[model samples]
Target: MTGRTGLEAVRIQHVLPYDPRQPGGVQTHTYALSRALSDVGHDSTIFAPSRPLRVSLGGTRADLALHPLDALALRRFLRLPHDLLHIQEPLLPAVGPLALLHPSPVPTVVTLHSAEVVAHRFYRWTAPLTRRLMRRADALICASPISHQTAVPAISYEPRIIYPCLDLAAFSAVTRNPEPNTILFVGRDEPRKGLTLLLRAIRQLPQAKLVIAGPVRHSTRQLADGRTTFLGPIPHEEIPLLMKSATCAAFPASGGEALGLVLIESMAAGVPLVASDIPGYRIATNNGDAALLSPPNDPDALAQNLLRLLDDAQLRERLANRGREAANRFDSHVIARQHLDLYQSLVPA
Candidate 1:
């Protein structure tokens, strides 16, 4: 009950480190939630780390763009708020949020979105520290059930599941008509995302074209067959159009994802998906039969799956129909309402 009047009385503040130019999944997720909440007559500000040159967009008036924090900066910064503070994290590499959580007046909720935490390889030492941070939260929201299950066993807290969302309507509307021979991939081009495998798969895929619309961290030279077009780091907004235009959106993650947001996005666009057979995709798609799920890290299998979808029409329609239905649960409006309900439940009546 601060900042604005009337329906805006129950204001909430969410702190995110969003850079418009290099926005990641967390930035997209947080901004979409804030926008959706605003549509439903709730007021919230996304306190992002300062933009490189202070770029302003239309929806920014309702959100705050804060500078990146030092030790002193965070101490002073966390002091101000609308109601509760929602921290979006992959978790800090060195120090956890204990410094902020210990004396903070605002009730905090954190949406955990890290594969490393579950994999237990990177920063294994911080397992205890991460759990401690979870205990301090007034509430916790996870991007997927896999993340929830991973974090739940390691920590004392049990977070609620709120899958990373997509603009379902936008995706659905965009994919009414499609292009032939165009394929899409929307993830970091690391070995983990199986870009290598995808590239290998593409070698066997004759005449079809693939556009890798993400960063290529490793040697792209090896994967550089004549048929592949590597358009590095396309904007998030532009991805839907790309997916819609494509014959199918591709994801072949080797390790795993908490949720396959891109898969659902492709599904929303009515693009058939060729993804890995992981628990995360299984959960996100609800086994919707929209995607061609195959074994992890297998280029041959990946290629075959993609080929199958491309060759067949009835299979594609089956996937498109089922994916459209399954993707409804992740609309920004519905997701924001779920978080709002959780917030209301957590706050004292």
Candidate 2:
């Protein structure tokens, strides 16, 4: 079979460490990338644990848990047939490391996803093992320059930087009907996610109504009032509508991000953004060009940026236009083509 580019189609096996049911960046990337590859006339299958149910996207679910038995299941799956094996977050335990360590039947490409992995003491202790596992990969790719830099110290090799892909067509199709003074925040309920800071910032904006998405912790739930609405753990298909309904989106993560996918999603939806000024977010926003940036963990600064967007409709319009333009670079088709080119290079024509 040949793809649209007139090259022989390649069969790719994507290995994700986390469960697809839990909404996160890496899981979303795997689903979007696989769908994109399929759209471009390639065979892409995802292999991951089946916690409650398998992902709706075409793939086989394994009953393997995070134990030694996972290697046995992976060994059996590897024998099924594939031209290339793409493992996400190879430094993670159990499946990711096991797959990288074990001999593979095909060329392997490993994507490093976390920027904070190197800072952990566990990574330091297992640096030698991680380095050996990484050497087995035929190609190494990082989702962002921040991830590339973080991997160099541990792996002793530079990885090619590729921005994470998004379904731009879906977001672009969404109708923009921004609610007046409406602010949206999407992420887990972790402290590093800066939901606390966003809550504090909302306190200063009396007229602003905040919408919280994803899992909200019990402690954070108590803080929600009549002004806040929590739509917890929405389906991926509903994200475009959620993004379109917002006046502006806010991502206030204090740290621990490789590249914020929400920033790209917000931009693709043509919603104005006010995100943290961190290394990961800076890469996503093109150094604060596409969105308003404020110092991380500073509620006062975050509030000021949100206020500016709320008060001035002209500024919001300008940022929304710039954001849509910036999001074009990370379109799914473009990123899928890059991956296909890499796979073609590794495999035969």
Candidate 3:
């Protein structure tokens, strides 16, 4: 019912800029869904950072630009008729003003992507605010069951689980030739991502090569084993190829109480996964289907799991096959439809 309306009939407001140069799961998901919502014939407006890139996404007319909520000039734009307004993230640099604009006459939906307050120190200031904003929105969305379970207890209403999506077509460039021996980790080189433990795990398997493809700051240098290669933030378009080149993906994820998009992205590229045994990973994999799970934060356990997957080709194949199926659920188009349903539920077409 959400999308079953005319263009001017349903004005869905989305807040988030589409910056291709900056690669991140939230950026990808926000832009992809905003574009899809337009394709389904629903009119929408995008409010985001004050300074937006001059370029436009491939096929969506989101009227992209910065709306800096606090700006005096943008106050009039905020009053425009909108049936639904979707806020992507609840942390600062994003939700700061969006939260203030909440309880608007129009229905609002806020997504709790990460428990950054616990993950990073800078975000500690946002934890209480995040809890407050969660109660303010008419609807809430979570990328994983674990995320919802961890984040929603503080809010007045239960947050619905609507997994973040991936546009599979974006990764069609990857050539899936079946060489399941290498391991890839596509995340920033933060301490919480468990980079040190991954290095120790790689050390356990001498033959296995590891490629960590993300921005590696000084913290990354601390864990730099001469053998590991940091490709320095590859473009999202090339992520599939990078994953395809490897036998599987590795994520010693320890930062946030949320799901890792890289794991699903790797699976979509037909690459098996080797992830931490956290609640988020367990909910994402449904228990070791798309990846080999090891005890969380334990390099030795991760090493054993890596060694086991590397040595057993048949088991690796099984995981890959199962992972492919689970990955399908996160396809952008399918997930977009689910969001449409949620919006309609709140607006009541």
Candidate 4:
């Protein structure tokens, strides 16, 4: 199990059921984990949908050929020399059950990234299936306390809490922007993500501008006041500079995040945060020590918090410095070592 250099270099196979063209926290987390494993002298390969990707967000890419549950695919995966099969966001109906049945021979670890799958209107029918899958996992990894709470009732075993890892070195390389007054928001425009609420809050502040990164699904009336700028689908490498240049970062997601990677990235860049007081964010920030909390779904509270951070330079600096320190806990090397330890525990002594 140990390499010649006295290090554990186990091979890991990460299974992702989601599309690569649509980038989100889960995609970012998978890619970061792969890179982190490599840094630790371990090998990681991703099994994702077989599609022509429009954009390349480079990690170790391999194809699952959209048949993750097929008998041939299952056998193929089970036969691999990989020590562990890590199923990211294992709530998908197709992939979750595969761990329970044919591939039961392999030691498997399942990471549950969101609680939404249990409550989504379309996925409600799959509740029983999801619970069974959760119980079948050899070792379960919850991305945050909220995610752990959601998985606890469904499974008989205790789930280990591992915060998603971040590439802090990349963010540290970027120089912090001087005289930053721009509030940064990164994520798709969705009801659950609170994009509308963010725009409404922007209307209340005349002295601040909000930089909306990522794709927007809903069209909005022209708020040509020059207070908000939409930069669609920003490159992943450029995100550190964007966070570094931010006066403060805002993520007002109302609910359903296992762990907010954007919040972690902002914290890593030493940028102050104004996030919704949801369980996911609350657990990540250690009960609001790392960031300011505004009540969810209330545009006025969001606006007030934004104004408070924008108007007070001393408050922003204090929160930013604390956030940077807190972000160290989620660094790539630290998280990778924790995961390697977990993988070691699952194997025979």
Q: Which candidate is the best by lDDT?
A: 2
Per-residue lDDT over 275-332 for candidate 1, one digit per residue giving the tens place of the 0 to 100 score = 8998888877777366789899888899899899888878888988888877887888
Pairs that collide, model 1: 290-319
lDDT of 3: 0.69
Question: What is the TM-score of candidate 1?
Answer: 0.85
Instruction: Tell me the tens digit of each residue's lDDT in model 4 across 119-159.
Output: 34333455566666666678888887777665554555678
lDDT of 2: 0.83
lDDT tens readout by residue for model 3, 209-316? 788887777765676676677788787777777866787778887646466677877776777778887877776786766788888888888888888887887887
CA lDDT of every candidate: 0.69, 0.83, 0.69, 0.74
Q: Each candidate's TM vs. the true structure?
A: 0.85, 0.93, 0.82, 0.86
Which is superior by TM-score, 1 or 4?
4
Q: For residue 229, what is the lDDT in candidate 1? A: 82
Check candidate 2 and list the clashing pairs. none
Candidate order, lDDT descending: 2, 4, 1, 3
State residue 348's C-alpha deviation in candidate 4, in Å.
2.5
By summed lDDT, the worst window of 10 consecutive residues in model 2 runs over: 55-64
Which one is best on TM-score? 2
How many times do residue backbones clash in model 2? 0
RMSD of each: 5.8, 4.3, 5.9, 4.6
